[model samples]
Target: MSDVRTKYKDIIEFYKTKNIAVLMGGLSSEREVSIRSGENVYNALVNLGFKVTKMDVDANIARKLIKDNIDVAVIMLHGKYGEDGVIQGVLELLGIPYTGCDVLTSAIGMNKIITKELLKAKGIPVADYVVLDPSNPDKSFNDILSLGLPVVLKPVDEGSSVGVEIIKEEDQLKGKLRNYLRRHPNSFAEKAIIGTEITIGVIGDQKNITILPIMELRPKKEFYDYEAKYTKGMTDFVIPAEISKEQEEKVIEYTKIAFKTLNCRGVVRFDAIISKDDGLPYFLEVNTIPGMTETSDIPAMAKAAGMSFEEVVLKLLEYVKW
Candidate 1:
């Protein structure tokens, strides 16, 4: 941690005079959510006395970025082109530094199937799952049997809980899969872990990393869908989650390992399912470009860890190296 601070101090001081671009609102299903996060981050950076630009990202983003001479980019974009490493690749080509994971990690982190495979290979506990393409939805059904009923069908590369379904019975499987395919056109199914869902926030690069407090997400309905995730009062967040000390320590430890295994940088949040029976935590997925809204889980976790939202945002900015 001390080494992380020392190695990144030059970048941090350079940020004092840099023109930061807050990228958000790409042409994705999660545009609205990205806009919200972008607004929050833009406002915070402005309050922190940085020269900031709010860019509604699109195909012309590269042109705009080069034209504006963006010293660093604060990526507040979610889903599709934003979180899938497209923008990061663009930044790389344009010779600009940005926050969050690099191209490889960002692309892998957003794809649930890929992320699951990576975690499984690392001996990390993850729920059973199968990938489904538009040409072969029936194959997914076959894979679902092992995972049992009441499984979760979700878009492979989407966030903000878009195109996610919680199928409670085998009878409803076909219809749900058909409907989801009609909308998403490409999706996957995962065995829904019926346990407490928690998110752990981690910061820094490969050389050094720090784990923030754990946040327990309690949804009102069957699962933490889009509505429950974003809608006010639809969910409850318990920071420094009310888990045993051992469980908390294990969660923090696993969170760090997962972040390092993914080769993630900047700030990321890992979602996990803690089984009530044995207290074992299963790694669900990692969000490399997590939401930056004030009410977002990462921010909540940082706050619980004695860091304000502004400080967390600034801390992330400090790590942006070109």
Candidate 2:
């Protein structure tokens, strides 16, 4: 076995002939983004001389994988069935080694409410939040009021900020509810942590976790909404966020805590907010399957750590446990 610490291109030679399945595109709100991510993974793997197949996943994903005789699955799916552990569970049953966390970790990571509560119980700082089941949309409005105005309402299980909303005024709450609930019946509201929004990307195995440079997101808009996240120039990324050494250390520490407490595996990104009030980093959410496109934050963070796009892809595949 070669040292996993060796350069990526060299390590990749070991798996050149393995049948790889780049799983992307599914019945999720983020289907298009997943397709792009899968394309990145596909191109990178092919460029590295791997026997790879790009599978635009659908309802019959298992059948497709069976037909392909895939030796490993590089998951690039986002949202619902893709990110919520449904596909991970299927892959587990099929005995297919896939990227990102396992089924249980994927389930906890995708559910915003559960992730927040679990983190809070472990003394990991998280923004105060309330979960409202769609059947009882109005139930948690008052509870959410404790967070005050400018609260963020998001789907409990959705990713890529598909149905995230910022309610600055009381009048905006109803409209947000109507629109958000339509997409995701179960909604969660959290007090907006007013401060610098930083995202930390971590890579390495379960034993040794390596933190990439912290990324500070400066969106042209009020917050890092979906547009700011995907649109090329909508947000400016500050690599190795300009902050005091203490603040950067805090961000890395808390993020690593979330990674371990969540029982995460492979590479994962932890989004956090450094509150302007006390300058404390508050846990936002975990992206188990972080993006792989050129503009994706994880790759940018990896590049800051001196890893190329090909190297990042190879490292992700190398870190796969099952």
Candidate 3:
């Protein structure tokens, strides 16, 4: 993979004569994070000698693209309209090539319940979960008790752990569900896996995907929520995760399978839980358009794998095909 450095020479030459656009700052809940990522990618491309345009995404995005004559779009937006394939669909109609997964894969990967079901169908290990609708708040607590106590209640479509709650006691389940419904309107509950949390960052084509070192997330809070994830020093990231070689190998293998299962391209990240009792890793969810913030997991894993941010960004650009 060291050849990636030399391989980028051709990409650099191609970019020297092409106009690239870094799309960011959508109206999603993650708009602020998107802006940060776009700025980073924009500056990195400029430093690498590519003619770049930093476009804050708006409803008039198509007109903006035509006006700027964007040859390639480097998507830096996260969550909702950005990561959920809406923007990718628009780009497809405009006949523009962009970075990251295609529309179908992006949409599937962004939805937790759908991604879990797909993985489970492939015989991959995933925590047992039940989907819920806020309109019908008449579910029995006994039904949830079937999954056991200490369940995780979260929004089905939200990212950044916006409405996730760790219900430790049975009495608090209904209240938490009500609160989550107030925000999400449609959410679900999953049996919480009491074990180590790990994330795998993958990049490349379908046939040659590379999984970087696994990262372990130890949050000060009970779980890795939005604050613990985005805030500095709230969580400890252990590279190569302190797991057995066999366990590590299993995670890498499953990570690749999960990536392919979703037909993901460019770069993607998967989060999983390693059960302490059995040492088995269970798939949690996949992020098609993973965050690119400096402190994000993908970047951290890439650095551990000896790849610089510039190298990852440049490699991603090369992988983007219409």
Best candidate, TM-score: 3
- Residue clash pairs of candidate 2: 97-322
RMSD per candidate (Å) reads 3.2, 2.5, 1.8
Candidate 2 CA-lDDT value: 0.83
lDDT on C-alpha atoms for all candidate structures: 0.83, 0.83, 0.86
Arrange candidates, best TM-score first.
Answer: 3, 2, 1
Lowest summed lDDT window (length 10), candidate 3? 134-143
Q: lDDT score, residue 141, model 2?
A: 62
**Model 2 over residues 1-322: C-alpha lDDT tens digits?**
1232356655576577678898899898889889988898889877777899998878789999998888889999988788889999999999998888889989998888889988888788898877766666576666667678889988888877788888888777865675566676787888899999899999876688989999999999988887888889988999989878999987777777788898888888988898999888898999999987766899898888887777778877878874
Model 3, TM vs. native: 0.96
lDDT of 3 at 215: 96
Task: Give the TM-score of each candidate.
Answer: 0.93, 0.94, 0.96
Clashing pairs in 3: none
Give me the runs in candidate 3 sitting further than 4 Å from their true place: 1-7, 140-142
Model 3: per-residue Cα lDDT over 242-285, one tens digit each: 88899998898888788888898998889999998688899989
Each candidate: how many clashes?
A: 0, 1, 0
Regarding lDDT, does 2 or 3 come out ahead? 3
Q: How far does residue 102 in candidate 2 sit from its true spot (Å)?
A: 0.6
